[model samples]
Target: MNEQALSVREAIIGRRSVKNFNGQPVDLENINSILEDARWAPTHGLRNPWRFIVAANKEYIKFQDVLKEYGVPKWKELSEEELEKQMKKFRTPGAVVFVVVQEDARQKERLEDYAAASALIQNAMLLAWDQGIGTCWKTPPFIDNPKFREELGVKPGERIMSMLQFGYYDDIPKGRVRTPLEDVVTYYGIEENGEEK
Candidate 1:
């Protein structure tokens, strides 16, 4: 499918988090194309802080190994069966993309960078959905671990934001219902003296 041809509304409504993948390999070109879309996300002060490290095919195995190695200290308490189950979850995805953001000392700048990276992630998810690729953006607890960060090559002034798993799936999951607009939205100007006009 020509993802560029998809309407923004369609992409927004159609995108769903897919947990079950068919073990199909996604092309590197397609992944790059999706990242290209994410690159255009709006940024404050044009900081453009989003950075990605993609692990796919053979590289994915190494990525899993690194995660496991760093994760062992935390999971050492788990039984052998539990550890195996936990490891199985990481094995299925066709690719794993580590989203990182450069730290800024100023609080405002740091928040802005995080917000921009979030927009980039949303754009990536929608773009991938347009091309029939499914994604799950996970911020596992280990992402913040100092050892895990060092193993993943996250720099001194950078932080891992998300771990996005992408692949093709055998089934398209159903979308969940959103809260009604009236319940969540408040019209400030439209109300007069605490009463609706």
Candidate 2:
């Protein structure tokens, strides 16, 4: 844990999706600690259907070449400056974790696995936030690319759910106001007009 751990309410409310990141390297040890706690997320039938492929520190440099080949389209045509600008999104993040989940044949089990993995991702984000690390959950189209999947060694019946980027940031993005609770919530046994069932 970095510094003092925040309360659950504080963590949930304060966390934001950070898209802009400073190029400072994030320690792999810190990420490991965060995921250690995140693995506690609910898994239906104890099916811990999630796994991660992490690229951090020096490894991130080599990973960039892979991203350039697969993630950037028509890189062969772009000027050096144009390519640099386009690659900034991938270059800035200090580390990235490709979150992969098992694709069960059964619809119910598959859905359950995805749901559990979603929770695990959220857990990781919140845990990262508590450590003063900024993170973004990205689902870029390249994740599903057959060549890209092969590069990451995603086997048959496994799917990448997120490209979770983590790093330090210069500014905290402002949080958006959520839909009003009154508008989103409904009371059971009460009609829309306030009549009891």
Candidate 3:
């Protein structure tokens, strides 16, 4: 590992999921370029099932409304505190990529194929990291709501794998929790008879 390449690797390793954003408007051209890089991710059978959605004026309004449906009745009512919390949704690079898994007939286990497609989100995340943008790949109340999927133009058999929240960060992101490579790596496996072959 050369020093420069190692440093870049470390930078990626140090990336974190940032929640608080400055509400700064990011450059759309930069976002588009990042998406361009993201498309390079390997997909099975070249389905390119992932799709992106940028939350603009009306989209942002609909986003909040959909989020309201996921919470308690009081949240739907939206008190001042509730309203305050929801306001953060508006604050971002002003773009969101609704990574969807389009229905594919090629595979019996389509869910696994969808999962493979969802892996592209990491490519998008890392690309954003390189572009001085912070991201939060949210898969919460957003994914569980089927109606939002339809509203977002998702097809019948398709599903929302994740909601990638992108933005420029005013605050520095915190560190991450990672398991050591030594503990996780498995170099070789023993035989079925428990003999080291």
What's the distance in Å from true for residue 105, model 1? 0.7
Candidate that scores best on TM-score: 2
Collision pairs in model 3: none
Per-candidate clashes, comma-separated:
0, 0, 0
RMSD of each: 2.7, 1.3, 4.7
Worst 10 residues of 1 by lDDT: 67-76
Best by lDDT: 2
Candidates in order, TM-scores: namely 0.87, 0.95, 0.77
Query: Sorted by TM-score, highest first, which candidate order results?
Result: 2, 1, 3
TM-score of 2: 0.95
Candidate 2 C-alpha error for residue 126, in Å? 0.4
RMSD of 1: 2.7
Candidate 1 Cα lDDT to native: 0.85
Global CA lDDT of candidate 2, please?
Answer: 0.93
C-alpha displacement of 113 in model 1, angstroms?
Answer: 0.6
- Give Cα distance to truth, residue 99, candidate 1, Å: 0.7
lDDT of 2 by residue, 1-197 (tens): 56658898999999999999988888999889989899999999999999999999999989999999888899999999999998999899999999999999999999999999999999999999998999999999999999999999999999999999999999999998999999999999999999999
The lDDT of model 3 is 0.69
TM-score of predicted structure 3: 0.77
